[model samples]
Target: MKKTLMILLATILVMLTGCGTENKSGGLEISKDVAFGEKDYEKIVSPANELGFKLLKEVEADENNNIFISPTSLFMALAMVYNGAEGETKEEIAQVLHSEGIDPEELNKANASMMSVLNKEADDIQLNIANSIWLNDKFTFQKDFAGSNKDYFNAEIAEIDIADSKSPEQINNWVKEATNDKIEKIVDSPLDANLVAVLINAIYFKGSWTNEFDKNETEDRPFQLLDGSFKDVPLMAMKEKFSYLENEKFQAITLPYGDGEMSMKVFLPKENSSLEEFKTLLTHENWTAWQKEFEVEKGTILLPKFQLEFEASLKGALKSLGMKSAFDENANFTKMINEDDQVSITNVKQKTFIDVGEKGTEAAAVTGIEMGITSAPINEPFRMEVNRPFFFTITDEETDTILFMGSISNPVQAK
Candidate 1:
């Protein structure tokens, strides 16, 4: 076999990683999405999109994580941090984000464009992206640093006193609002006193599949696990002409939502193939090509009606993506604040919400890069029953931007 990254690590990580926790439920209205023109957006998104594969591969290698992440949320949060970084700290992050040759100015412009296209409102689709930077009022912040983020990234600059008892509630409230209450408590109480800043990116998405599945057809079906055992999961069955692809290795399909500008693509390994073996075939190139390979074919697709809230510190996974010094104590973040303030990334964490049902899909993710610390496919005509572990992605069809990516290893926990 090539290389195997256990695919069910997501299940394990959800338990170990401080993932989804609800604290006061509600949504908060933010400024608005920024549009600097979609000109260079693809330049940055395309390369950074490569990190998704690297992450899954990392999860595979670690084999102790629940596989779910928001590529847009994670990268955009880092992009905010990148602007505040100087020298080697900047260089290392650039390489990890795959924007080594691109100018920071151009990359910033591209990111603005990417956010604009993905966060825009569409018929039958509600996609919202919120970015913000929280600073300790006790310290002085660099204006140029904050302005670049506000103007280019459209981030909300909030100066909150960390010493206050209500700090976590204050920040988590914004997170709840940004994600439509899907993610309620990303900021835990007892704020790290050493935390000088908190940079956040929240994405909330709710879309109905163009062809909704009939609820009557939904039934509990046997879903095989990696351990050669099985569990019952509610599988919503639908038969229609779906953009699908079938090859020797896997069966795939693209189920469009709203006006077809976005979709949820699923890839299920063939009965003879395992997810571990199938993961070796994953690459950014293959994902790009797989989206184009789908031909509208007739078949039945049975997907589980499941929901999960996951959160985890991404330090290790990011390190595997070629990032280092950013997490170092002596890391360079002078541009973010004064050198005496001395802040490097103390923690980098993300909390995600994923749900798929007969109505459609509601997916959200919040990526927090602690500055306080310094921080597809388808083919169906052949019955594509996701009766086992499989991978899925909520994507922007127009831009091919992935909002949320995940794998369902054990649907027993799924609703």
Candidate 2:
């Protein structure tokens, strides 16, 4: 694990981190067909938690999240499309996504996308032609923002000239009226929209702990930081066995979200107990090893109650992750938006918010494929031992997108 220190405001803090792909030779499969299967969604969700952990470290100096996605929505949208898509279109869509650096073999190995991937992390989500038309057009919704083409004020909608009697104001107003506020502008100016289309994904999760953490035992415990310091932070502790695993690199614990459908897993390194050392060991193989060892058993746990937030521009990140062609204006999105002609994704933007307090966790996220696309404090007694560095993430068992990614070493500073 490599380490970097970023100085924000007046405080300097150390940061450590981690990506994803296939399951060959230890790599997790990332293909749409096989992506949902093989627990690829779990694979993706795991790293996201690592990202959250990293952000928690950085935010110890500031109060801004740095990653984004709506896990539940992303999963639901993927589920809808998975069940909705059939025959050639389904296979074609799968291939396109797989070609963008995912494993095609896994996709081919599975039959129904819903059967295998629903409740699993999905790499790509799709909607049927009917659903897209109904939600994006026929349905009435508020528009986000609008203005004349000449004045150029609306950030999302620009260049629509109001010269034809309507003026920018009316033109903008129409957009505001059409989207029902789900979309703010027609054209994200500077960026042009050749044609109009909509892409929506939804995810829902209900997971319960194999063993619930006892609120009665929650208490503030000292959280160790990378700088060799400790702060008294509340940790939610419960004495019950869970699916626990330990390897030469780190100690691991798996806590199911609500139903058995979703879960949150944490990984902490041993010996050096540093983020860098643990990150170097966070690989598909290591993940596979941990998964193989996971067993439904009894155990004790002490987790921190903290909230986290993150927002990021994912265009560059997606491009770097291998979907370069999709970013091209000439790329193929016919299957995605259900158009005869290909539509390109001009911009992608995303935002996420999470809160994990004493009364369970509440999270909300929005990803605009501009595209586009928590915390806690404890005062009560009962020990919530979230000391040392740990990982956290939000995931949908359906689509394989890691909606939000982060970590926390010092929960007190994790704004």
Error in Å for residue 75 of model 1: 0.8
Q: All predictions: root-mean-square deviation over Cα?
A: 18.7, 21.9
Model 2 lDDT per residue over 1-415, tens place: 2111110000001000001121111111223322234443453344333433333332222242123344333322222232223344344333323322233223223322332354233222111110111122312212311111001111122222322334333433433333222223333332222123233222222223445567788898998876678899889987665788876777788865434444667777786566666756655456656688977677777889876666655456545434455445335433333323333344444455555544344444444543110012355668767768888888876997688878977667544
TM-score for candidate 2, please give it.
0.49
Taking all chains together, each candidate's TM-score versus the true structure is 0.77, 0.49
Q: Please, what are the lDDT tens digits per residue for candidate 1 over residues 1-415?
A: 1111110001000111112222221233322543355476778767777876676676432242347776666677777777778888888888878888655666777877776676645457665556666777766567767777777766677888877879879877776666555556665677766556666655556567888889999999998877788899999999999899989999999888878887778999999998878878877788888878889999999999887766677888888777788776657878876445545665566666667777777666656565433221253567667788999999999999999999989877645
Off by over 4 Å in 2: 1-112, 115-195, 257-261, 295-299, 329-342, 357-360, 371-415
The lowest-lDDT stretch of 10 consecutive residues in candidate 2 is 7-16
Candidate 2: C-alpha RMSD after superposition: 21.9
| Residue 10 of model 1, lDDT score | 11
Our tally of clashes for model 1 stands at 25
